[model samples]
Target: MDVMEWTGQVYADTPIVSAETYVEAPPARVWELVSDIHLMPELSSELREVAWLDGLTSPGTGHRFAGRSAHDALGSWETISTIVDCEAPRRFTWAVGDPGHPSSVWSFLLQAQGEGTVLEQWAQMGPGPSGLSLAIEAMPDKEQKIVFVRLREFETGMKANLAAIKGLAERRA
Candidate 1:
């Protein structure tokens, strides 16, 4: 949203939302923000709360977590997520719902650039069961519209998250 153009990808009918910004902090500084599962609710509006499961103290592949979210239109719900990828100081990714066939895939990619980290937040909705899938099924004729609205919501939220992380990382740095 800052200087990056609007970007998205599609995978088998699922819409992907991705946005990146330059954070005035080193990769390690930025990674501390991105890798902390418990910090999300503090930085997000829709994400009301989160917690790690299985007594995990840090993120790695196969770690599980739960998140609770709310929206004026969507109301409130809780989700189960699994860490699908974790590459320190560079990339982190996770899957919502069933890990084997996730309802959504979300990721953060960090690249060191000119003393700072270019942090990107990404999300892809549904190749399996999801609230979006349920909504689409309920209104098959409005699939495109549904996807558009949902992706827009994600885009806006991700941008806000990036901005907050940038501020925090820069302040701490």
Candidate 2:
């Protein structure tokens, strides 16, 4: 697991999807586990591994990371992500390249919630290409339903990931 704060100008104007959860740990401890990009696999069962593609220092802006995630005995997806923002023990953001359906930006924010920590995750998808939009428009109602169904599926996947993180942080206390 190689994690670095992302600092770049290429994607300075991307949107983010933010979701939050409470963990039974202080902000500093939670930050240790979440900030270490390489240790993410150890923190969650769903994360198989995370690697740094570009050699860089830890938790610094503009560091690149890639990781594989699985859906407990069902399937998995591989993403090559680059850190867009890195603010220790607080917030971090990443962008996944050419994710097939839509290019996406992901972010995480951590805050102290009384004796615990509140973790928030956000994702932004789209900036779709012309051809992709055309194809989506050409699809019939049934096909359109399938598309939205898959979008929900992705959202569920994100929820599971967040749950895993929460579980890990809680157990540490």
Global lDDT of each model? 0.86, 0.63
lDDT of 1 by residue, 57-106 (tens): 89999999999999786688899999999999998999999988888999
lDDT of 2 at 49: 88
> How many clashes (backbone atoms < 3 Å, residues ≥3 apart in a chain or on different chains) does model 2 have?
15
TM-score of each: 0.91, 0.65
Per-residue C-alpha lDDT of model 2 across residues 1-173, encoded as one tens digit per residue: 11212322121233333356788888887877667787667644556888887776477666777778786423777777777778888888776765343356667789888999888766664553322233355664444443444344445555666687777778887
Error of 1 at 37 (Å): 1.1
Candidate 1, overall lDDT? 0.86
> How close to the true structure is residue 48 of candidate 1, measured as C-alpha lDDT?
88
